[model samples]
Target: MNVVPDPITTQEQASKERENLLDFFARGLICTTARAVGADHGEPSEEALTKARAVADDYLAAYEEWLVKLTADNAAPGPQ
Candidate 1:
C-alpha cells in the first residue's frame, strides 16, 4: 500500500528547495562578477570593471530585497 505525504513535510521540503535555488543563483552572480573582473590575464579593462561593479551592485540590491520579503513572510502568522 502507498502512503500519502504529510503537508507540513511537503511544505518544508519546498522551502528547502527554494532556499537551495536562491543560493545557486547567488553563487552564479558571484562567479559572473569574478569572471568579469579576472578576465584578460588577470587584468580586466576599466570598462569591463565598471560594468561588473554595476552588475554586482544590482545583484546585491536584489538579494537585499529578497531577504526583506523572506523576513516579512517568516514573521507573518501561520494557520492555528
Candidate 2:
C-alpha cells in the first residue's frame, strides 16, 4: 500500500538532500581545482593560481550564504 508523506517531513528530507548535494559539489570542486593546478608543469604561475583561488573562494562564500538563507527559511514558521 502507498503511504502519504507528511509535508513537514518531506520538506526536511528535501533540505537534507540539498545539503548532501552541496557537500558533494564542494568536494568535487576541490578535486577539480587540485587537478587543474597539478596539470601545469611544476607550479602554476602565481598570478594565475591566485586568480583561480579567488574565484573558488567567491563561489564557496556565495554558496555558504545561500545555504544559511535556505536553512533560515526552512526553520521559520509557515502561515496557518
Candidate 3:
C-alpha cells in the first residue's frame, strides 16, 4: 500500500507556506512605501485622488520591481 503523510504535517507545511507568501507581499509593500513616502512612513498626506496619482505616476517602476520579485519567487526551487 502507498503510504500517505500525516494531516498534521500537511497542515504545518501549508501554514509555513502561507507565512512565506505573506512575507513576500509584506516586502513588496515595504519597498513601495519606502519609495512613495519617506522612510518614516505615515498615512498618505494627500487625498485619495492625489494618492492615486502618486501611484499612477510611478506605476511602471513599481510594476517592474514587483514583477522581478514575482518572477524570482516563481523560479525558486521549492517552498520556503
Candidate 4:
C-alpha cells in the first residue's frame, strides 16, 4: 500500500520524456537543413528545400501542441 505513483511525479516524468523527444526531433531537423543547403553544387533544389522546411515546420507545430497538452494534463486533478 506504499510507494504509489503521484500526480506531480508522473507529470514531471512525462514532461521529461516530451523534452527528450523534442530534442531529437530538433537535432534531426537541423541536420536535414544543413544537408539541404550544403549540396555539392552549392545550390539546393527548390523542391528539396520546400520539403525540408515543411517537415521542420510541422514538427515545430506538433511540439507546441504537445507542450500545451502536457501542461494541461498536469493541471488536472486525481492520479493524473
Candidate topping TM-score: 1
Candidate 1 lDDT for residue 68: 94
Per-residue CA lDDT of model 3 for 1-80, tens digit only, reads 99975564577896775455444555555557777876765554435335444445366457769989999999999895
Clashes of each: 0, 0, 0, 0
Cα-based lDDT at residue 53, candidate 2: 56
- Two-way TM-score contest, 2 vs 4, winner: 2
* Candidate 3 lDDT (Cα, 0 to 1): 0.61
Mind giving the per-residue lDDT tens digits that candidate 1 earns over 25-76?
Answer: 5555555668789843444556655555566557766987999999998888
Candidate 2, 47: how far from true, in Å? Answer: 1.5
Worst 10 residues of 4 by lDDT: 39-48
Q: Which candidate ranks first by lDDT, i.e. highest?
A: 4
Ranking by TM-score: 1, 2, 4, 3
Preferred candidate (lDDT higher): 1 or 3: 1
Give the distance in Å from residue 62's predicted Cα in candidate 2 to where it truly belongs.
0.9
Q: Give TM per candidate.
A: 0.46, 0.44, 0.34, 0.42
lDDT of each: 0.64, 0.65, 0.61, 0.67
Off by over 4 Å in 3: 1-9, 38-80
**lDDT (10s digit) by residue, model 2, range 1-80:** 99975554577797776555555555555557778888534455556555655665577679879999989988889952
lDDT of 4 by residue, 1-80 (tens): 68865554587796775566655665566566677988344344566555555665678778789999999999999897
